[model samples]
Target: MRKNEDNKNIAVIYWSNSENTEIMAEKISNGIDETGQKADLYNVSQFPIERIEDYDKVALGCPSMDGEALEKNTFEPFFEEIESKLKGKKVALFGSYGWGNGEWMRDWEDRIGHTGARLFDEGLMIKEFPDDAGRHACVEFGKAFASF
Candidate 1:
């Protein structure tokens, strides 16, 4: 509802092997735009983790892999790269999962908490491709995250 962040920049970064998470990231970006803000979307490999401090807010996305865990190779290392810098940062999280009760998100949330970042809200998780409701929720999450 608030469009005061016209000049603010947000980052939506994610890792998606099947590209489902990419769609969610794009939806989050659309939500940020609804708030009259800017969102830069990036694949985890394409984003420079050290540049995380450049954005006013950040949205991180990844799919649950290898038993409801963050991807061991790319996303995990990228997240670890930015973990320390997250202290005092504003952040949101989203992901697509094949199954397993969203335990990966819970673990991720706990990690984010330990970093002292201000969590925008509960992390959004979608099973495989997000349905209409999931996409709507992602948009809402983006709008709220940008406004905050």
Candidate 2:
């Protein structure tokens, strides 16, 4: 675990079609705040990929589309642009889904891992709208990631 005085900067960027992922992103930021770490939250549309290298930790959120992976329009390009910048960073993933198994999260984890970023924990996922348990889990994920 990193020392509390490390002062690492963390960022959470998310794209949400139905607002669920956005709420999760806020919860993640809250968890990071609880640990007394600095966190920045941004919508994927406004996320500055060029600045990713300035952060020590990053958490990305995207809803599943067509039972496949991240929403294509914003997330795909954003991810691609930042992939090469992620080596050796601490990262986490989260998303909301309406249907299908959680294969999207697994695939995303694999892809991010390939970039050499250490995943903080298993990716956080929710079926449709997340319930209380799921939100709490996301918060825990944030706390754990901050400490990593």
**Cα RMSDs, all models:** 2.9, 2.8
Candidate 1 lDDT tens digits, 1-148: 1223555568999999997899899999999888777788899999976688777688999999998999999999899989999888798989999879999999999999999999878899999988899899889988888877
Model 2 — which ten-residue stretch has the worst lDDT?
Answer: 1-10
RMSD of 2: 2.8
Total backbone collisions, model 2: 0
lDDT of 2 at 84: 87
- The C-alpha TM-scores of every prediction are 0.93, 0.93
Model 2, position 63: C-alpha lDDT score: 88
